[model samples]
Target: MQKMAVLLSGSGRTLDNFHSRIQEGSLAGEIQVVISNVKDVLGLQKAVNYGYPAFHAADNDEINRILADYEIDIICLAGYLKLYSPPEKLKRAVINIHPSLIPSFCGDGYYGNIVHRAVKARGCTVSGCTVHFADENYDEGPIILQKTVEVGYNDDIDTIATTVFAAECEAFPEAINRVNEMGIDFFWDRVAK
Candidate 1:
């Protein structure tokens, strides 16, 4: 199984869900490292409980050290809110999950519940989640997978969040599977890997 390091700056529900999949044999991989930029993140404890190495990376040097120590194949971001500048050697190896479609409901202050609120305010008929490669920019990368959720007339911020969250719980694993299974492919008129 391939190893992946998850980086999240918030509650860490994504990591917890992945752990469950690992136990059930739905997802296969070792969580070599769990790096949270925030010290007080509750998800850190979840990693510790599962006996995965967890740490707080305060700066670029620290980030490089952690990534090196783990020999991680991919750095996955799940609700991590910090600006992460991967070492030049590892930039191509990181990815992230954003709760909205790219170049759409994504930008500054457009994360967490803020995303749901904006979707409702805009009266969107549909909203969902996106898993994309991570780059220096915010939520702007080549899209890997997306799951759309219907937005009904009665939808509120909480309801929208719930709808997207469910998709996330599944989409994360699916996207990872796609990357590890098929890899990304492109061609002049066709693509494969």
Candidate 2:
């Protein structure tokens, strides 16, 4: 199993899903550490409750130190809002799950409910989650996978968010498993392009 470090800025819904999948032997990853930019968010609390090494780190240098200390194999950004600059050696090891189809509603200032609201405002017929390598920019990395969810004209932001999150729960683990099976070398080539 690959060792993972999870970073989040909101509720622990994605972290919770990872825990559930790991417990059920579905995901081929072990969460080594959990870090949150916000000190008191549900994600940090859930990490502590799960008995994983958890911390509050708002500085990118501190985050990099923790990742190095833990010897993390994969870094997963569950709902992290901050931009994390991974160390040179770990550039290809970071992954993130964006709540919308990338290139649509992703970048600085676009996340969570904001993304959902944008989709609604645009009258998008479909919304989904994108699991991709985390580059220096926000949501601008090589996509590993994307799962689409049909959106009705009347679907509210909350409804759209819920639908996309369900797809996210499946997509994140699938991406992690794919990385585990295919190896980072495969992604290294893709990300280099």
Candidate 3:
């Protein structure tokens, strides 16, 4: 199994969902580590409760230290808000799950419930998640995968995020599966480049 590390900046509902999937034997691996931007985010506690090593790191230097110390192979940003300057070890292996379809309403000010709110306000007929490489640009990366959700006439922000969250759970594991097939180190160099 490939070692996985997750980064989160908020409540980490996605992380919880991933952990649950692992426990249920659907995800098929270890979380290894969880890094949070804010020390007191509720997700830090969730990681602790789940017995994963969770800590605070504000920038790339700290992240480099953390990943090196843990010998992490893959880094998935699950609601993590910080912009990371990748060290060579993490460069190719880092990925992020953006809440929107990206190049559309995802980036900078768009995150969490706000992205959904923007989509609903714009009257988008569809919106979904994009799992991609982490780049200097927000939500802009070579796309790994995406799963779109149809937006109904009456869909509210909450409804949209809920639907997108479902897609996130599925996309994350699928990405992980593809990662496993790629064999961690091999793909990291290519993707990172």
Best by lDDT: 2
Model 2's alpha-carbon lDDT is 0.91
**Model 2 error, position 126 (Å):** 0.6
Between the candidate structures 1 and 3, which one is better when assessed by TM-score?
Answer: 1
Residue by residue across 5-83, what tens digits does model 2's lDDT show? 9999989899999999999999999999999988899888899999999999888998888777887888999888888
lDDT-based ranking, best first? Answer: 2, 3, 1
Task: Tell me the TM-score of model 1.
Answer: 0.92
Model 1 stretches with alpha carbons more than 4 Å out: 184-193
Which has the higher lDDT value, candidate number 1 or candidate number 2?
A: 2
Which residue pairs clash within candidate 1? Answer: 9-80
Candidate 2 regions exceeding 4 Å error are none
Per-model TM against the reference: 0.92, 0.96, 0.89
User: What residue pairs clash in candidate 3, if any at all?
Assistant: 92-192
Query: What Cα-based lDDT does every candidate model obtain?
Result: 0.81, 0.91, 0.83
Candidate 1, residues 81-184, lDDT tens digits: the string is 87678877667667788888776789667788888888888989999999887778888667788999999989888999999999999988888777777553
How far does residue 171 in candidate 1 sit from its true spot (Å)? 0.4
